[model samples]
Target chain A: MDSGKTTKEILKAKLAEGEPTPLYNPEALAKIKDNFAVWKETVVQEKDRKNWEVTPKTILGSDIPRSLLYTPIDNENLDYAKDLGFSGQEPFTRGLHANMYRGRTWTLRQLSAAGSPAEVNNRLKMLLERGATGTNLALDLATVQMFDSDEPESMGQVGTVGVPIDCVEDMEAIYKDIPIDQISASIVTHYPRNTSIIFPMYLVMAERRGIPWDKLPGSVQNDFIMESVVRSASEYIPPRDDFRVQCDNIEFIRKYVPRWNFITLNGYNLREWGTSGITEMAVAIANGVEILKDMGKRGYDPDWVGERLAFFWSPANDFFEEVARLRAVRRLWYRIMKYRFNCKNPRSMWSKCHVQTSGVSLMREEPMANVTRSAYHAMAAALGGAQSLHVDGYDEAFSIPSDVANLLALRTQQILEAETQITQVVDPLAGSFYVEALTNKIEALILDEIDEIEKMGGLVDVVDSGWLHNKASRYIQREQKMIEDGTIKIVARNYFRDPNLEMPEIWVKEYDPALAKAMMDKLARVRSQRNNEKADNTIKALIDACKKGGNVMAACVECARADVTVGEMRRAFVKAFGLWKTPIYA
Target chain B: MASKKKIRVLLAQFPLETHSRGIIAVAGMLRDAGMEVILMGNALPKQIVETAVQEYVDVIGISTYCGGELALGGDLMKAAEERGIKKRTSFLIGGIFPPKDIPKLKNIGFDGTFLSATKEEIVSCIQSAVAAKN
Candidate 1:
């Protein structure tokens, strides 16, 4: 009793009054009055100068409150293990890989293309020469997304929206000198039904070149759920048949190309639609889980399916918040796979995501500022440990990324890796008080969102009900109002003015009326040249497979061999499946 | 039955080839500002004449975004003339139709062309062009 008293006396003598430790706070309200006062001044400044009011914003990752004022007491119950897992562990609240960027740098993939595939191919070679590790393909909406170059729906549109890939010849032409075996490529299109057919063209090229199948190291944009949502809005394909296409592709990829990741659950598009980071994580997690479950029902091993399963997310302007969101996603995924899905494989839970800087944040005015925005977002993604990343060009808002802007975007990542030396440490912000607390908060929020989504009977229910669409629309509307009302200051539009700077020469693809005609002519020539009977038989077989509940990808492969264009295959399926009608909210 | 007064105009919207939503919206606004509007939901070469003849339109609006606007827009204008509506009508394009391409649109028989993202401003441009005699 005497020794205990002495020890207490010694500890008390050495300690300061109410120190509160790292994440704890025992400071009185009066003592912390300065922080509140600063916050109040900020609010007053915002309200008075900008005419904007800061609400208790309930964003995705941070659920405590949307308001800036977050007391330590708000997160008193946030668990270190149960709520926030350690970096590089299951429930990867911090990161996916153990070493993170210390072992490998984040991929700097800029969404790029122009004019013809042949023209774009030369540009891609230039990008590669200038130190791009991966090539990202942006398909023109007409040929790649809609699968038709000359349809009434596609008039005055080809190679203008994105890089136009009309046929197998175009795909082969784009990937000419670039070795697909060594580098990774990500195509930003949601037509798996189209991509599945288009993929074999590359395989055929590889076969001719003697490139082994195992050496092919690129990814197909095969996210069925993501496609279903976007196409649901666009009225592209029916939901039921969309799932059928997705599952069929999953089964096919599992059997044939073990190395190639099948689909990347595209939360980036959903995020672009205006959901918070937490909502993006939850919806994406639910999407991934639902797909895995569907694959399991189709007799696919979760381990095999999970191996090829990857994800795509968007990192916005919010720095630490975005980092926490990434961390929380990996952690929550680990838990769901282990506790919910009963997956035993350690690898099954790891989140492999390709993150892109949010394009929405890129403004048309003072567009050059977007370079800095992208660099910051890229830094957050790297710190959060993204395997691959695509930085939006400074001029992304007005036009499709110009070649000069793409070079700058690529250089942003290169500069971070080569000059910054920030990648030397794993989870560099690991034990920071603010980062830890935010990670815990983000994890809790994501789990809660996943729970809510699961109760809605998973991602399918959310899409079918137009819940995601409405949510996204609402989010967009709010952002639009904010921009219009000057609540969200978009530099030259709302806040600061650029008086002297001359508008740079906007790079635009000169109208190639011949290109559109050439595309139609190509499609017509292929139809006239290819064996019509064989093509008919192959397409008929694919339709039959869709009805008979057999693997449709095998039939799709045959369709590609028969020179079945993406439009014909998509049209045949749409004719058989009918189209998905979206709910009219107005 | 002498020729009765009827508003005749063309409408156009497209995803690619660089046509602006602002241009289409402006054209719609111009028609609402009391000119006849004949809208096309993105027609190709073969359908352009069919649309013009079917509507008996006085003017056609082609919105192009994908750099090939001049040639495609020019081709559509030619197709309209060949179909015997040449002297009776006019052609106008709006969107990223560059200033450099102004002469080309003129050479192609386009009555006038306006840049995208200026609806209220382009209203006067359209009216002035409409008021000018051949």
Candidate 2:
């Protein structure tokens, strides 16, 4: 009789035989312990006076207490093969690639978008010319909130946060001269519902340019977590329906846009929305697991969907913790894929991520210091084996980055790639005792949190029940209190508060009212000029798809070809799925 | 002697702007400061004013992280005036607007504008604005 078990499962069961051996010999460890005790009594005790207690100890975001020093004792049970595998191997704790940056550096992708599509196009061209290797398109608040430019709800907000794209025309205008096939573009559609509406426009634009869908190389942030947990908007679709749309988008993109990363499981916005790094990774991984299970139920192999799946993370100010977190999540993701999902493809197991510097860490006071902060965050991302990076601008604390600020951000990554010798080595901090121990600790903590979330009926139920929001709320308040009480020292914000210090004037990009009007006019033109009958039919089809549990992405692509606006397509989904009042406030 | 009434406040984010961390933190702070807070999620200026008028809140704090503070702030004031709560309700603006735009927000009938303000400072400012309104 066939047991019907996978090779990975069989091997995993076989490998869990007994307790692992210690890295160091017992005699050597005993000798070190004796020497350490002697040193602490003679040298350490003489210097510090009272005991070995260091006042006000530091702690990581996961509440891991830091010791004075970490030795082999801390990682005694860390088997290199099972735990920190070699780069490009099973359990790729070192890195996804063997050579890492030495083979090819991480993509210097600066997030740039603002004003109208044409204006944003200009900035995109300028950034590419100035050394940005990829395009990161951030949508405007109205677009992200799923409202047309002409809607009253979009007043004073069109093209304010990022570029506004209403229909295929706006999409074409944004990528007019830019070669869609040449460079990858990260369409920062932060929600699954919006991704279904907006990404199809990009696809249609590429088709108009005669670019095949298979040739498109980019990603859409098609994570429902953004809509449900991170971004608080006026309206929301129910979590269950949003998750359906997410899986639909993933299934469609995986089939057609073979090169495109269907979903960048977003933890950047989640962490920036006031959660710790552990929570961010746990939530994202939990979301990824739920997505895999859903897709599996849809008759798709986990490896097929997981190959193009990627992650987006925010590397914060905590240097080593961020580095260790990246390493830990990489290994943890590989473990989940290999053991839980029975994924055979190596690419499916790889936890490739794009990192953005933490926007919340930037302070408005002495804003120039934000440059240094972002640079450090960028460095941490690089050391942590990020596949791509977006160093946030100093003015991010205020408004969208001006041209100069954007250039400085680009230069930050360029400098690290060119000047710093950090990239020459793969997983530069791999063997460090402290980093390894922290990596082990963070991995365990994230897995535990993921377990807890699963116990609470998984990500969808947790989000729908507002448990995630409540957790975020508590962290938000605690972080604010810490900063306010000078516990979390932010320079110029709390610590060395200097009101009279001479500061360089940062040029904030002002919102042009004409830009909003122009967007509205263009949207009106698109509405009047397009085939309204075709648009209406496609929208109805979209509504049908949404209501009947059909592929919403296919309907969205048809709607895009028919010149349906983003807001209109979104309205179709809303009309079908109805609105869900987020359990944001208890 | 009757106890003093709690400082009733309505805290909201500008419509379409999704950054809610600051506003959420402020809601916690206001609640801790013994104020009754009616938190709204990304409401339009009209909705915010109508809610304020209906709830008869003492203070309205609008947090706008994205740009267009001048336009949104002006519209909020206009809505308050249209509802005839311009004088009775204290309007405050906070979050990541440029310092240079503080005067514009104030000129647009905002009772107070805060940029990078501490929680203590915000609570005190709200308290004083409510006191002056009374």
Candidate 3:
């Protein structure tokens, strides 16, 4: 639990000797190959023992050969002190802090669904009252896409998936009377331009409430490259335009909002899209590395850029793999930030992140069973040392979580925090033979994937080549087939087939139809009431900024204050940067 | 003749600007199974129906998350009917839709339901739909 390595100490020896050596011992790895050969030949070939055909759910070692029992031989190459260091030190394989949860508990964040701003505010208040420390705002599709509730394209889906915020007033209504600057508020959005919309609204909201813009807290998921590569949401706008907005917003936040976590790459959603944990993490890191390189080109140091960055991942049903993946990403990012990018500040090497339990792992058939599944995911995330966590509601597969279900999800985390003694020790699973070996394997897999991506130019190029999309699609297709063929199993849906089982009442409350209407009416009223000339003028300035390739955040703030709705801003952006050629069916 | 003709299927999201994750995967599955897959990223119901008529596609597969599909699926079918190609084209939908909405999807005249359908089921449905179209 000591802060073992100084940046000077680790950086001096390694950075002096050109490229950094691999974390594992080369001689020991060669010996493992020898041992594995004999074990496979003698145990299986000589004894005529047929090992069961086991299919792996993880990315690595699927179709390729794998040993049934891993041992000290497999982990002989691993160096605990050298590779892992102490938890608080460089190459933070264990965690960012030495004592971890014993020193401070992770922020308890719960996701919100679509509603009127007032309705969503009530939900946030209820969540805060229930011991939640962070508000992970989930914007409706219309809002995320920067469409107004009344837009013809957004008709049926308004306020369905998340809260619909049309302008500054709507955003102000969402946090009404809740102390805006005190708690963390993570704006969960993807499209870079749309995400920039919320930043101005948050700043303007604070300005009106007599709070400084610097006091506003929380992170934004502004990595549109990841959206393009893995999440498939990048198809909403041109990749080049998205990347430009990302750099502009991050630069703005770094200058003004010093306390805010300016940017994050949420790979959890991509896991649902069918990419494996290691692949997704590798892609996320590759995207981060590309950002570091871009910052260098723009005369910004890697130190300041890395300081404002965070990551988000999913802890899936594959318990050991998920644990290993969490451990591996930290180590990999550390190596990349320090050795590759030469980030001088020690804070830049640390990978700060939260883990969300995989919603795709939840099944609609047996809603009660999901409660247990979510608990285990939370436990895995905690043990693996996530900075924060969001447990999926038991009824998530059916609809937006009911109040009872959301409360129970919070209880799952609280029990882990209070009743369990898992928080007592740091990295409890650190030295387990299987876990250590698996962690090394995951690291190796991620490095290999990163190498492949680099060889294909970079993350942006990989996305442009359309390779990442095809890769994810292939993995998803294989996964669906495996489940169908009984290679992978879900409880009641695929395996149980309980004909007489009656599904329990899952939907405690359906989304109110009146709320969507109310949101539209509020948008109309705000437009009618606010300064039209100011809105028109500010929008033109925003369009000029976009055309001149200038930072558009300030212009956006002025527009927001003038009650320019999201829909109008969308047109201004289109007029300046042109519309993306949406993929055609034919 | 239809079996010999490499059946073309148009894949899309139900005209609301949702993420392209679900539809992208199914497009891969259909393409791998020897069907010509046209990925319409995120086209509206009318755009989907027009593409079905214009391309002379044998199948139209769309996915939605919840609630919206009930109306959008109905819109697609209605648009297809107005174009007089509703009978010739097979309509299918998929997503983590609520059970209550399943009946409404059926009422909208979709040829097949693919709520979380597996690879084999998707391929088999596409094949069956193409054969039915023939």
TM-score of every candidate relative to the true structure: 0.77, 0.94, 0.89
DockQ of 1: 0.16
- Which ranges of candidate 2 are over 4 A from the true structure? A1-15, A18-21, A41-43, A46-60, A499-505, B1-3
- The 10-residue segment with the lowest total lDDT in model 2 chain B: B1-10
lDDT string, candidate 2, A1-586, tens digits? 1134432344357458768755678888888888877876777656554533332311115456676767887787668778877888888999999999989999877777777788889988987896666788989888998899888888877777788889898999999999889888988898999999999999999999999999988888999999988897888889999999999999999999998998999988888888889999999998898888888888989999889889999888788889999999998899888877878999999999999898888887888899999999999999999998888888888777887887899899989999998999899898899899989889878888887887777789999999999998888887777777877778887789896854345666667788888888888888889889998999999999999988999999999999999889878988999989887563
lDDT head-to-head 2 vs 3, winner: 2
DockQ of each: 0.16, 0.72, 0.42
The model with the greatest TM-score is: 2
| Fnat of every candidate, listed in order | 0.17, 0.78, 0.38
Instruction: Show pairs that collide, candidate 3.
Output: A114-A162, A114-A163
Q: Write the per-residue lDDT of candidate 1 for residues A42-82, one digit (tens) a residue.
A: 76565454433243332222224444444544455444555
lDDT of 2 by residue, B37-83 (tens): 99888788889999999899999998887776788778888898988
Q: Per-residue CA lDDT of candidate 3, range A1-586, in tens?
A: 0123332234345645644445557787788778877877777664343552343654221232245666677666455565778888877898899889989988777786557778889988887897777787888877777778887677677777788888888778888888878988888866578767777888888888899988888888888754455433322456667677777788788888888887787677666666788777878887787777777777788998898799988887878777888898888788878777777887898888878898878886768899998998899999889988889999877677887888899899999999998999998898787788888778777777887887777777777666776677678767766666777767887778677766564563334567778877887788888888888999999999888977877788888888788889878887887666433321
Output candidate 2 Cα RMSD. Answer: 3.0
lDDT of 3 by residue, B1-134 (tens): 35688888888775454555667667767777888988766667888888888888989988767557776777888899999998888888886666666677888888778655567788888788778877
Q: What TM-score results for chain B in every one of the models?
A: 0.76, 0.94, 0.92
Candidate 3: misplaced stretches above 4 Å?
A1-55, A58-66, A230-235, A499-505, A508-512, A581-586, B1-6, B17-19, B28-34, B116-134
